[model samples]
Target: MDIKLDDLTGSKIAGLINEHLQGMALNSPQESIHALNLEQLRKPEITFWSAWEGNDLLGCGALKELDPYHGEIKSMRTAKEHLRKGVAKKLLQHIVEEAKKRGYQRLSLETGSMDAFEPARKLYASFGFEYCKPFSDYKEDPNSVFMTKELFKK
Candidate 1:
């Protein structure tokens, strides 16, 4: 699969992001939802990417720069037909590699704490992410699970 930097203008990417938002809403309470919308994901601090095979989109993910040394993962979603095919894993690996190349010392993410999110939590843990307190603008929320991995320790 080819993973490329996305500008959030394509219809495929937009639809995938909308689906992600809908999934978040369905699984988490309104007050605990932190998933960003298309416009929000387009912000200058965030770098978005989409994975594709030929013309079909497989999945997408984003990395938001919190500071020179830290970054956050966001909007990780594998297309319905592509679930369990390692699409999320490839997208996640791509994001982590990009963070390392950018000189980030830490990578973090927030996902739901519900059972629906178990696979995601397991995926992150497999990549060395450990449960942590909220980071950036996030506050403690029972509905949210935060994980972080140190890429380069000082």
Candidate 2:
């Protein structure tokens, strides 16, 4: 699979992001949905990536620079047909490595708290991300689950 920085203008990425938003809507209330839209993902602080296998788009993920030493994971989604094929895993690994390369000391993310999000929570846990309080501009919401991993030991 080839994973690289995406400009988010392609139809495949746009469709995938729309699917992601739709999935979030299905699983969570509108107010509880924190997933960024394409315009929001294009902000200067965010770096988006897409995974591809030849002509097929496998998955995508993004990293947002919250600060010089901290980053936030965003928009992690594996294409419906590509589920369970390690697409999300590979994208996540790439994001983490990129965060480390940027000299980030911490990497954090927020995901849904519903049963629909169990797999994502487990994936983050497997990466050594521990449950944490709301960081950055996020607030305490029962529908949200916040997690963080320390990239470098102090």
Candidate 3:
């Protein structure tokens, strides 16, 4: 699969992003939905990427710089047709490698704490991320699950 930076164009990546946002709206509360729309994900602070196999978009994810040494994972989504195919995991590993390349000491993320999010949590756990207190402007919310991983800079 080819993973590269992309714009907010009308493509399968954009469709997957919309699907992810809609999924969040359905499973998370109104105030707890931190997922970004295509326009918001196109901002300067965020870098978006889509993974594709030939003409098919497999998955996508983004990295948002919260500060010079800290970054947050955003917009992680795998296409419905490609679920359980390691798309999300590959995108996540790419994001982590990119963070290391940019000198980020840590990578953090916020996902749901509900059953709908267990698979996501498990995926994150496989990457060495652990539960942590909320960072950035986030506050305590029962529906929110915070996690972080320290980069080894290898």
Which is the leading candidate under lDDT? Answer: 2
Q: For model 2, how many clashes?
A: 0
Score each candidate by Cα lDDT.
0.96, 0.97, 0.93
Off by over 4 Å in 2: none
User: Model 1 over residues 1-154: C-alpha lDDT tens digits?
Assistant: 9999999999999999999999999999999999999999999999999999999999999999999999999999999989999999999999999999999999999999999999999999999999999999999999999999999987
lDDT of 3 by residue, 32-76 (tens): 999999889989999999999999988889999999899999999
Stretch of 10 with least lDDT, candidate 2: 145-154
My TM-score estimates for the predictions, one after another, are 0.99, 0.99, 0.96
Kindly report which residue stretches of model 3 are placed more than 4 angstroms away from their true locations once superposed. Answer: 152-154
The residue pairs that clash in candidate 2, if any, are none
Q: After superposition, how far is residue 60 of candidate 2 from its true place, in Å?
A: 0.3
Q: Is candidate 1 or candidate 3 better by TM-score?
A: 1
Tell me the tens digit of each residue's lDDT in model 2 across 49-128: 99999989999999999999999999999999999999988999999999999999999999999999999999999999
Model 2 scores a TM of: 0.99
